[model samples]
Target: MDPPSSSSSERWLWWMDDEKKHSIADTIDIEKSEDGEKIDARKERIRDCMTVLGGFLSIMATGGAINSVGLLQTHWENNQLREYSPQTVGWIAGTNIFLSLFVPVLAGPVFDRYGHIWILAVGSGLFVVGLFIISFFDNHSAAPVTLGMMISSWGVLCGTGYGLIQTAVPGVICRRFDRRRGLANGFSSLGNSVGGVLWPMLLRVALERLGWSWSMRAIDGLALVMLAIGNGLMWGSGVPAVGIAARPEPESSDNEKNKEEQEEEGREPSLTWGQCIRDGARCFRKGDFVWMTASLAIFQFVVMGVAGTLPSWGQQQGFEDASLFFYVVAVVNAGAAAGRVVVGSISDSLGRFNSVIIVQTMVVIVGFGIWHNVGTNERLLYVFAALWGFSNGAILGLWSPLVGECVHTPAPDHIHAIIESLRLLTELVCGVSRLCDVENFGRYLSAASSVVSIAGLLCVPSSAQILGTLGPDIHVIFFGTLLILSLMFMVMARVTFTGYSFKIWRVV
Candidate 1:
């Protein structure tokens, strides 16, 4: 005989052990046909896209409230808590910001294990409850009680809820889309910009007409409806399938043992809580990741600081009309929403790192070139608001995709965990920095631009005091320096990933 036929050989192997033969046969039976697998994969992608849409709604609601804090700050100052110092009132908003940034570090892992629905459910409930509580204590006489309610309900409860939703939604997106991740992430992040734009205008009108009490209840009611829709969409999408690419079976007997070994190697062992902590700590030890984290931290610190204080800055510059001051925030956010969608789509072609570099450069020019000499020119201020918002908004929108690119990993949970941890650390630093010097609010804004720039505050009476003195504007100098530093670190990260090749189109 020439040689045993392949079928004969398999039959011989099958007869050697009945249990092993059945196990092998069952595995083969369970494996999908080629066309069937493709069909399933297409279905999964469609589901994931729907899930992303749900995530967008969730972010829109939470991001709206967070971004609208400026309006609330103005309301407190002009109305309910006008008797209190700005510093005292600022802490209420500051606490909420701090918690929103910081809680995600812990929530990321919980979301990975538990799934998105319950996390979102609890978050939605807390957000609604927080707003309701605040509504009850809106009277000026209950200023002290309102402050307590704001901190407990809005700051701790609502912030934590937003943090959970924010963390879980990104995790969902990261797992679902690989090829078109930039577009997916960008679209989802648009929730923040849209929320920022709409909420400020709504709150402005509510404050003017309804007073603080009804305004709080109206917002609460709105959040409840949006969140219900979001939760429903998320529930329908189901949990995302984990890991990168699915493995194909070995074609030959010689490869079977190797394939088994590869499978064993790829399997991630469950980690204890201590091991998880240790693993998170180990990520910081990597030089490239550390630089990436630093860049993100500095960017957030600078942008949030300036954006948060824009209303006050406009007022101080003699925009006496409350409506005009509120409009400044809305205009910036509207530009931000537009920038997020446009730049995000462009990044798919230009490359994420290249897009980030260009935007950062634009921010530097806008801060120094336009904003520095804006003075009391209302038109110039609006121009600065539009350009700065658009460029800065792109930075926030692009960062998730950039972080995904820099970290060399196929596991979405691991990547998300790392991102959340870095964000928490960045926010913690920003929050503490803001809280320390609440007295000179302008100095806090300057200090937020860069760690080095905060030193500039020591000698100057205020941010405005050093504006014309040190070139056309001190704030621009501080912001530009931060952007330069952030750009340097980002380039270092890019170089580590793709080497120094200007011709290379995509670094990731």
Candidate 2:
């Protein structure tokens, strides 16, 4: 013990000498220090911020486009790729989801240990390469041979660069917010709806103005711009050494005033994998998963189905883009982007679970009937777009937070992964359903919309359509019914939470 003390003293004495010398090699803040604390200067790389923001935007793009190709599935079947089946074309979009979700498990850890600059860089490269691949591959060979649905579009090139952004986004958000986590989350998620609205219009324009090859090339170019911006922004946001934060960085601080307040936030030290698993298991055993997963699953069903059908819905409603299929998708996405924030804020105040019920019910009642039926009128379609944008937007924000309610595990990773996988499938199904209905010329949609509205009312936690008839004046009535039902369920949940935080059903 005496000998060890002598050695420890020598190490401290050496550190003190280094500090006195102001040696750059030994100095923590020799380059630039955040909040005036000693820090490894290299930790504050500008590219890291851009990587974080880009990561968020990347996922937003994936979510928007995941089910989007279905909007084109019918078009593909009828026109340039008439020989292709709907399911085959649908697979391209499906593949996007599959790779986007399942393949990126390691990304979070990678970003945590290393920084997101290279990840985002690779993402940018993939986006460009994927787009270019689709362009040349779609054009070069003849219909059956070059156009073989199995070979080209679905080929490995498609999902590669297309979704690198998604893999990066959440990790960035996680790093940025710990206290007002929900607020940061709300804004970050908005990117999806924004991308949803904007991309469709972009695609619509290129489809008509540029035709197939150049149109896709144009999109690739646009993606390049987005990527460049992400790179620039992320690069500007400096990276800090892991586990070294007494105060926020001035350049890229979370912008919080009270250090104590920041400490109180959700960004607390995350539990170890073993500990997380233990908590997650207990929560699942309690049955929180059923409610949370059901809610998210159903929410996706409505949103994805709508996304898939939006362009065709517009087409059936007699608002065909003619040459701007992608453009129309952009319009729908734009509305969604605008309205989703509305949904998020409102849901936060009204109750996350309740707000979803209210929003989806309205979509079903008015959207399918008044909007879908009247969407045939140009002015009416404008109204419909506004209505759809507002409601669907709410769903994105409301669902994820509820996962804690559903999955009580110490670690949410398992639940999040399973939900992501299941939700992807449901979205695919919803997309396919919407496309099939759209091809049937909008009649089927009108009927389904009414039924789905009622479905939202009954589902409170998931997707279960109780009504058989496509009821009349349903929108106005459902508005009342939705309010009543939402309040009722909130009361029920509140009572349960108050009683025991629903711990009884916590495990399953």
The candidate scoring highest on TM-score is 1
**Residue 312 lDDT, candidate 1, scale 0-100:** 58
- Tens-place lDDT per residue, model 2, 220-241, is 7776777677666655554443
Tens-place lDDT per residue, model 1, 393-457, is: 78877765665554443222223565556645754664311112222222222122233222211
Lowest summed lDDT window (length 10), candidate 1: 432-441
Candidate 2 vs. true structure, TM-score: 0.60
Compute each candidate's TM-score over C-alphas: 0.71, 0.60
Q: Residue 303 in candidate 1 has what lDDT? A: 71
lDDT (Cα atoms) of all candidates against the true structure: 0.66, 0.48
